[model samples]
Target: MALQISSDCISCGACEPECPNTAIYSGGTEFEYFGKKFEALASDIFYIVPEKCTECIGFHEESQCAAVCPVDACIPDPEFPEDRSQLLAKKVHLHGS
Candidate 1:
């Protein structure tokens, strides 16, 4: 499943650099994907782009953002419940590996 950042986020910017897929972003900061930059989803707290989030499935045993989050704001997105194979495929799509 793709992980999500909850409202509990402290906006400390810790999880932003920890994501292997660069899915996490500071609130209100524009993010890029496929070479195109766009506005972020949230403007008050850190957020994760679900399209770019693989939960670190291809690179780690667990979500790096969740592991390093001090406030435990990063949690599974029940709206996008995906299994290992799906997550791996998404990772391959993002990294082109």
Candidate 2:
């Protein structure tokens, strides 16, 4: 499953640079996919783009964001449940193997 930043996020921007897929976005900031832009998921806390997140499966043994998070606010996203293979496929789709 993709990881989601909870309301507990401190908005410290710690997890932003740790993401391999560039799925983490600052609060109130917009993100783009292909040629389409989307609104921020959280206006006051950092959010993850489920479609672009692969839990760092292709790039790391664990989610980098969670590993580096000081408050453990990064958790699995129930809304976008996915298995290892699926996550790997998403990784390939995002960045070629």
Candidate 3:
């Protein structure tokens, strides 16, 4: 499954750069994927794009955003219930195999 940022996020920007898939975006800012732009998921805090997220499966042993988050605001995104294999496939889809 993808990960989501909670209300506890401090807007410290710690998790932004840590995301291997670049799925984490700042509040109220636009995020682009494959030349397509999307609205911000959270207007007041950092949010992760479920479609672009892979929980760091292809780049790290653990979720780097969660690892570096000072407030532990990053948590599993229950809305998208994907397993390891699905996550890996998404990683490949985003960054190539």
Candidate 4:
């Protein structure tokens, strides 16, 4: 599954830039991917775009958002469960391997 920023997020803006896929976004801010702009899902905390997130599979050993998050708000999304191969494929689709 993709990673998600829980309500525990402190809105520190620490995890936004560390994402290889640019999937992380500040609360209430816009996010772009594949030349398209996506609406913000959360207005009070940092948020992750599940369709754009690959758990840092192809680019890193672990989720960068989780790694840099000071409050441990980044965690797997149970609603979007996926395996390693699917995550890797998503990375390739987003970044063009």
Supply the global lDDT for candidate 3.
0.91
Ranking of all predicted structures according to TM-score, beginning with the best and ending with the worst: 3, 1, 4, 2
- lDDT (Cα, 0-100) at 59 in candidate 4: 82
In model 2, the Cα lDDT at residue 5 comes to 92
Off by over 4 Å in 2: none
Report the lDDT tens digits of candidate 2 across residue range 19-78: 888899999999877668899887899999999999999789989999999999999989
For residues 1-97, could you state the per-residue lDDT of candidate 1 as single tens digits? 8889999999888899999999988888998998999998899999999989998987988889989899999999999999889989999999899
Count of clashes, each model: 0, 0, 0, 1
**What is residue 47's positional error in candidate 1, in angstroms?**
0.2
Candidate 3 lDDT by residue in tens digits, 1-97 = 9999999999999888888888999999999999899888889998999999998997899999999998999999899999999998998888889
| TM-scores of all predicted structures | 0.96, 0.94, 0.96, 0.95
Q: Score each candidate by Cα lDDT.
A: 0.91, 0.91, 0.91, 0.90
- Backbone collision tally, model 1: 0
Candidate 4 structure lDDT: 0.90
- How far out, in Å, is residue 62 in model 3? 0.6
Candidate 1 TM-score over all chains jointly: 0.96
